[model samples]
Target: MLLLTCPWCGPRDETEYHYGGQAHVAYPANPAELSDEEWAEYLFFRDNPKGPFAERWVHSTGCRRWFNVVRDTVTYEVLAVYGPHDPRPELAAGDPR
Candidate 1:
C-alpha cells in the first residue's frame, strides 16, 4: 500500500517501480586489474542504511527513466524524487524534507 512518488510520473503504486539499488556507485578506473574479491564486493555489497536512504528506482511502466528516491525503510515513507543526474541539496539534519 506504499505510495511512491516518481519525479517524472507523479505518485504511483509501488508495484510499477523497480528498485535499482544504491545510487552514486562508480565503477573502478582499472576494472581489468581488479581482483575477484574486489569485483564481487563492488557488484554485491552495499551500505544498506535503515532510515531515509537514497536509492535508484525505475518507473518501469511510465517514463522509464531511472531516478533517485529518498525513502524510509521502516515505514515505507517517500521523502523526495529526483532525476538520475540531480544534485541533491542537503536536507535538514533530522527532517526528511
Candidate 2:
C-alpha cells in the first residue's frame, strides 16, 4: 500500500486520493488557435517517468483541493505535497517532507 502525504491532510492511504496525471502543464490561452497536433499532445500525451515524478492529485475523500505531489513510481513513496501556488522543493529519495 502506498502512503501519500497530503499537503493539507497529512499522511493518508493512497486509496483516499485520485491521480490527476502530470502537473505543470498549462492550457493554451486560445484553444481555437491550436493545431490538431498540439491539441492531441495536450489531450493524449503523458509522461510516465520511472523515478521521481511531479503529478497532480486530488485528496478526493479528504481535502479535495488539487495539489502537486512528487512520488516514486517503483517504491510507491510520496516525496512531497504542496498547494498549486506553492513552490516545490528538490526531492530526495525517501524524504517526504
lDDT of 1 by residue, 1-97 (tens): 7788887778999899898998777889999999999999999999777877888899999889899888878778777788898876465687543
Model 1 ranges off by over 4 Å: 95-97
Candidate 2 has its poorest 10 consecutive residues by lDDT at 88-97
Per-residue lDDT of 1-97 in model 2, one digit per residue for the tens?
7787887888889899998998878888899999999999989898898877888889999979889988878776677778876677676566442
On a 0 to 1 TM-score scale, where does candidate 1 land against the true structure? 0.85
Q: Which pairs in model 1 have colliding backbones?
A: none
Clashes of 2: 0
Look at candidate 1 and tell me the lDDT of residue 67: 92
Cα deviation at 77, candidate 2, in Å, is 2.1
Model 1: lowest-lDDT 10 consecutive positions: 88-97
Whole-model Cα lDDT of every candidate shown, in order: 0.83, 0.83
